[model samples]
Target: MAPKRRRTVDNESKEAVQNRSSMVTRSRSAKYVKISDNNNSPVVVFAHGAGAPSSSEWMIRWKNLLADSLNAVEVVTFDYPYISQRKPPPKAEKLIEFHSDIVKMTAAKYPHHPLILAGKSMGSRVSCMVAAENGIRASAVVCLGYPLKGSKGAIRDEPLLQLTVPTMFVQGTKDGLCSLESLEVVMKKMKAVSKLHVVENGDHSMKIAKKNLELAGISQEEAEQSAVQAIAMFVSQTIGAM
Candidate 1:
């Protein structure tokens, strides 16, 4: 009998199976958080403020709020070294590399989705700096109560000026750290397109004073909901333009 013919079809099928298995293993190893069941939705990498860890109640609340408002598939939040290691917080510049790494990893896991960098006060400032860095192609940035002033009340406009990506600022009218009037001036100087949503009488944390809430005839939840809605609109417009 002639030499048995090699089973080319079987060999090819076996190779294909191995390739698929490898892909599955890689997928399983990649870390990611799913905020919604929707596929290919935007991914938000949210950083916490210097005073709080990623697990803080405040961070948790806003993370969920952002996911719902932006229709994001994932909202990834990571604690900085200080928060995670119980060390003193470092300068915002010092945290940029680590923050960029998290953003990159999250982007890699959701390669098909748009990336949005967002954060509270100090975190928001850092996010802007990271967004301005090389190789971070964030679709947009959401700055929740951006700290436009330093400890000594000096303007901190460098990061905002450096941003090349569209940005949305949800600022509190009552936030001493970022006066709306001063932000207006800074926004005028910024090179990137920027939008603002003023939270009347809200503090640095977007917390509306109970008295102010009563005066405005709206509940705290309602005010926050309105802010989130504004963010949604900003995100939609930004993505649509892109």
Candidate 2:
């Protein structure tokens, strides 16, 4: 009798199958796309804060700012499954898994370019968890309004400690959700190359008082522009180092 040959499973095909099977059937949250002028530029995958969808005003504005000002970066934003549903938000571990899957899918789609994981609040926390667990290396991570801890709660320090990629935390000086003091302590313990940019008198949503804005002779639009410029500069420097 002739020896029978065994067929090896194709890893790529297997992944595709798993991805398809794991997708949620319901339309939970929305996904938005902003294309950049520079073709083949690096991609910035953004995750929104808890309870907010990708179409939220903040995410839309950030996407536009990055796409228009960054020159060579495309921005993609997606909502977590929990937020996609009208139900309560998922637990942190579940959110992390969702973020990881989104990153993997985004990377697979744009295999030619590097990825930068950028998130706001809870989204940023989830991004950090994904990056650490998968050993995925991004050009950099832009954490906008990172939530170090909730009010009257103990802070989660593991994500910052385990991060190995270049990270920039853009925070408001007066953010109540995550205090500046707590963030400063956490930043000191981060293992990765990290920098913090504090927006003077800004709140948890990075919104400053109208009086201050007027005094600075800057509009809300201008503040957003400044933030985009800062992010672009950080990305440029981090990519250069790589």
Candidate 3:
């Protein structure tokens, strides 16, 4: 018997299909692979922040940048089931289960490609938990704006410390969601290979002040370019070593 051939989607057709498919709504469905070029590149799964959808402006921007700059990598973003609700959000356990299921399904779909897990804020925490609990081996994990504590100042410390994969934490110096001091402490305790990059004057969303941008004559686009460059470099180095 002969082996079955896989169907490959072209860049143009994939874009058209994605645009048309974006209209179909599911009550608790998570969005997947936004702004893809259909290049069938290595997959990078992205998780959105708490209270935000996968199509939020920031996520969309990042996805597009990755598609344009790293055309060989497909960026997939998914919303937590709680964020898709019409009413109150679901409990933490339910949210974790949803994230875990999405990761598993994605990994199965792209079984041969290198899988990278990337997340923002609460989403990053969930990604770390999924990686740890399932014993799943990702090429690398990238965390943007990781939250280290609750709004009321209570500390949460399991995600970073228990990670087994090569992880990179990209944080803003002025981010209010997570304290650099606390994150540093956690990083010091971690057993896995970890690295942190602090964007000077960047806020929780990696937005910088106009004054600073003007002083350096660096536009917001440039800042985003810098971030993408850093992430791409890290991904390349880590994947190469592996």
Each candidate structure's TM-score, on Cα atoms with residue i matched to residue i, is: 0.83, 0.79, 0.78
Off by over 4 Å in 3: 1-41, 88-93
Q: Compared with the true structure, what per-residue lDDT tens digits does model 2 show for residues 145-233?
A: 88887546878778888988878777776787777667766665677777665565678778889887666555556555556656776
**Candidate closest to the true structure, highest lDDT:** 1
**What's the CA RMSD for each of the models?**
19.8, 18.2, 15.3
The per-model lDDT (C-alpha) reads: 0.77, 0.68, 0.67
Segments in model 2 whose C-alpha atoms lie over 4 Å from true places: 1-40
201-232 per-residue lDDT for model 1 (tens digits): 78999897877766666666666766776677
Instruction: Tell me the tens digit of each residue's lDDT in model 3 across 24-64.
Output: 22111111322234433457788888767888898998878
Q: Give the Å error, residue 160, model 3.
A: 1.0
Which residue pairs collide in model 2, if any? 28-84, 29-84
